[model samples]
Target chain A: MKRAFIPLLILGALAVVSAWLALSFGSVNTPWQTVWQVISGNERGLPFDLVLQLRLPRAINAFTTGALLALAGALMQVLLRNPLADPYVLGISGGAAVAALCALLLGIGGLWLNAAAFAGALISMLIVFGLARGAGAWSASRLLLTGVIVASGWGAVIGFLLTVSPDAQLRGMLFWLMGDLGSATQYGVGVVTLVLGLGLSLPLARNLNVMARGELTARALGVPVARLRLGLYVLASLLTAVAVMTAGSIGFIGLVAPHVLRLAVGNDHRILLPGAALFGGSLLLLADTVARTALAPQQLPVGVVTALLGVPVFLYLLSRAERR
Target chain B: MSVQIPIIETRDLNLSIADKAICRNLNLRVNPTERWGLLGVNGVGKTSLLLALAGLKIPQAGSVHLQGRALSELSGRQIAQICGVMFQDSDDAFPVSVLETALIGRHPYLHAWAWESAADEAIARAALQAVNLSDCAHRMTNSLSGGERRRLALAALLAQDPTLMLLDEPVNHLDLHHQIDVLELLTQQVAQHGKAAVMVLHDVNLAMRYCDHVMMLFGYGEVLQGPVQEVLTLDNLSRLYGHPVRSVETPEGCLFYPGKT
Candidate 1:
């Protein structure tokens, strides 16, 4: 436990610094003292509302979304025994995106759009699980292959939806698909889930480590393999759904955060899950900061910045680490 | 006379897959201090039977009881308290340390949210030492050789410390010396602690040497089972395996060999 803390504390500290940067240094860069004064409610000006209302919520939302997606990805990787698996492995994001795109095309806004995205995510989860639990013995390959196929099928549907949508709404759909954190509100839901997931799943982290070895071995070691798998699937899917609801479909962080930790700490979920969450949160927060200030007044999508920052760094790390 | 209840028993157990009967009427009882060897050709349901006995799978018919209780009534964790299994192969998806792998055996003993105590860590370390893997406790499992992985599995089973140990092809991928060492360790555990075991072995000679009781399965649910001496005759062996077998008597008991067809 002590071994896990040093890295976690470091990531947490980095997260704090990133949040500070996001708050103080946006398009209209302000001093840290001004941001602090605004936070403490001692200052009244344009900087105050910008720091409190605009920057603070956006940064918190980005952090929570990144944390949830990365944690969900870590759990999914363990569950499926595939490092390539991300938060979107079971087609949840695909489902959510499809629903969100449809709503955008129909000019639906506000709470209804979030509701549709969640409903679609749930429907996708059911489709994959129901099909995977079909007749005969259960195998990891079967479940993973089923999910991949379902995801592909959802991709086809999403492509069709994109083609038929009117030109005016295309920008909204595309921006959402690319994941824009600028529009996110109600940061509380994602954070609550992130805490709940980390708290509840930490106890099961040991079990997740054993299960990744193999289902038969886990069962023989006395783990309720079926129940554990089901629980992980549901938890990871829920995290992904909520994340998509919060900030559209942010990519790369989910896949990259866990692998970076895997390189540092050898796949022991006890530390890896939380470590991934913190690291992922830091990454996205930093990316959001860069996105907001990189182009001055015109902000790039949070998802674009995450990939742009994540991919090259991840590749470098992968090249440095010995191939497993 | 004090009659001891069997540690593991199958009451008229029926084994099948996809509605086809693989074995039937398996009325067997395994007591403490006894070891049984399961012998069958490829695809003759040996692994399936091991899985069933370990309570990892449902019986097509009837029940498997552990210490006079139905296995279905017990949780997987509870069943694991009395029995531990070593598979022919370990999963290599994610890399874990040898010590960490061995400590998995202590899972049945720990609670859902409990971490393995220092005492548990000590036991796991002792198991690694026993397997001569103490030096490699920190080594990743994927980096180990086949023989090393086999020993790692035994070390885990040792850490489990269950009364009834179910080993499926425990000798798989082992060298000659490691094979003898593992069998000797198991035989010693059974002799000294009265531990019960059910093992599947492909080598008839090793089975004859190590196991006191043997079960030979003929295809389509026919079985020949009893005390090893009475059931392991050359004629019976030849017929059971559907190959000509020759048994030679030596100072080290009986050695069986396959005759040229």
Candidate 2:
């Protein structure tokens, strides 16, 4: 109990400090009080506008997207009972990426891209669920294999679409594929926040816990296993879709955050779910800060920065866990 | 403690896998106070029969009724509430504490959003005590020895407080003492609490000693089933194993020894 409490307290303190550092320490260094004042809507200067309009929304977007991705990843890992299973492992992100790419290449609007991505993700999850059931009732190996098959097929379709798209729209589609956080707006932030809040709450946490024990056990325990699994996949897909639509296919945050949190804490979904969300948010916010400040005048893509930082840390943890 | 209704009943049940018949035209009844031993050699479909009884496998033909309701029609949770099953080998994925795994037996009674109540916790604790695993409740399940895992599995079943228990090779890895301890516990539960238990035991001697009734499955669709002394004879044992065997009845119980004459 004491061991659990101390890490939680320390993580909580670190998150607060990170949030403050994210808001205050940019290329145009606004003072802590000024950042607070801007956040509170008491200031009306250009610095306030810079903080509120640009950096603040970007920070919040990164944090919320990270939280959503990590939550989805954690849920996916528990649901499949495989440490390697993440949001992308199920072809959910691939599906969303395909839809987003089509929207961008076809000259569709931004809002439509979000909807398209969400629909694609939902459809892909349904297909995966159906295929898994058809093959033989939610076997983890079957699900993983099915996901790989579907994801690869979808990736091929994405490649075909990209080849056929007009050259003028290619740049924007490429940026979306690479993942960017520069396009976050007030409305986008609000929408992602609402979705993230709903996704991270009680239902997902409780159901994820039940799912940690294999599906048959979950069913025997009165979990309505199929329904719960379907619901979780849909909810996770929705969260991933929103993140993908808003910030492109930000890869490693979703795959890495939950796993790191799991190593720090244990595999109890109640703790891992919330911990993943918070730690993911903090990590992404820090990554975004680096993306903006490292280049000064020009921003590196937040996705690139996160992947660069996440991979080594993730590999080290994997090796350490393997040794243990 | 004679119950009016049989806790489990099957009528002319048939099951097959890939056109290979496992069990056919099988009928059985289990009273709430009975302890039944299902004895069969390897590949005799003992596990399959137990799985069918536990509602984990669907029979191809005929019916299984649990307390007068069709087993197929009952929800998994409803079946679980009335029947607890211990599989031959369970894949323990997470490093859950022994107490946490045992507490999962309380799942049928728990609401989706609520934590396990104090009463539920107390019952789980009592189950651990019953299995002599109270001291190891906080230890990781993966850390337990094979015999300890079997005991923990029994504790999990006990925590469910079910009217019927289905055990598939429940004594597979247990030592002699622990095996006797588990059977004794089951006997006590049947006698005192009116719980019905159906177990698949490979050891005919253990089955005869502890089981009130025995169901023997021989190859080529032959079955010999009745009270232990009558059904477990030299002829039946020889026919089942496809080898010559001699059975001796000591003052304690019956034992079978394989030989050629």
RMSD of 1: 1.8
Predictions in order: chain A TM-score: 0.96, 0.88
Give fnat, all candidates: 0.77, 0.37
Across residues B1-261, which tens digit of lDDT does each residue of candidate 1 receive? 679989999998899877666679889889898989999888888888899999887888888999999988888888888989998899887888999899898988987667788999999999898878999999999899999999999999999999999999999999898899989999998889889989999999998889999988777877778888898888888887889999778998778889899
Point out where model 2 deviates above 4 Å. A1-15, A106-109, A119-123, A126-138, A157-171, A186-201, A204-207, B1-3, B219-223
Docking verdict class for candidate 1: medium
Query: In each prediction, how many residue pairs overlap at the backbone (N, C-alpha, C within less than 3 A)?
Result: 0, 0
In the order shown, the candidates' DockQ scores are 0.72, 0.41
Cα lDDT tens digits, model 2, B1-261, are 554778999899887766667677888888878889998778878878777887777898889889988987888779889888887765566667888778878877765556777888899999999989999988877789989988888888898888999888888899988899999998998889988999999887888778888998774555667887788778887878778988777887666788866
Q: Residue-wise lDDT of candidate 2 within A126-181, one digit each (tens)?
A: 78878888946676688888988999989999899889998998877777777778
Label model 2 with its docking quality class.
acceptable
| Model 1 bad stretches (over 4 Å) | A36-46, A136-138
Give per-residue CA lDDT, model 1, range A1-324, as digits (tens). Answer: 666778888888988898899898877888999988998889999998899888889999999999999999999998888886898977899999999998888899887888898888999999998999987545778888888899999899999999998889888888899998888778888889999999879989888988887888889878888888889989999999999998899989999999888888778888898899998888888888888889878888888988888889888997887665
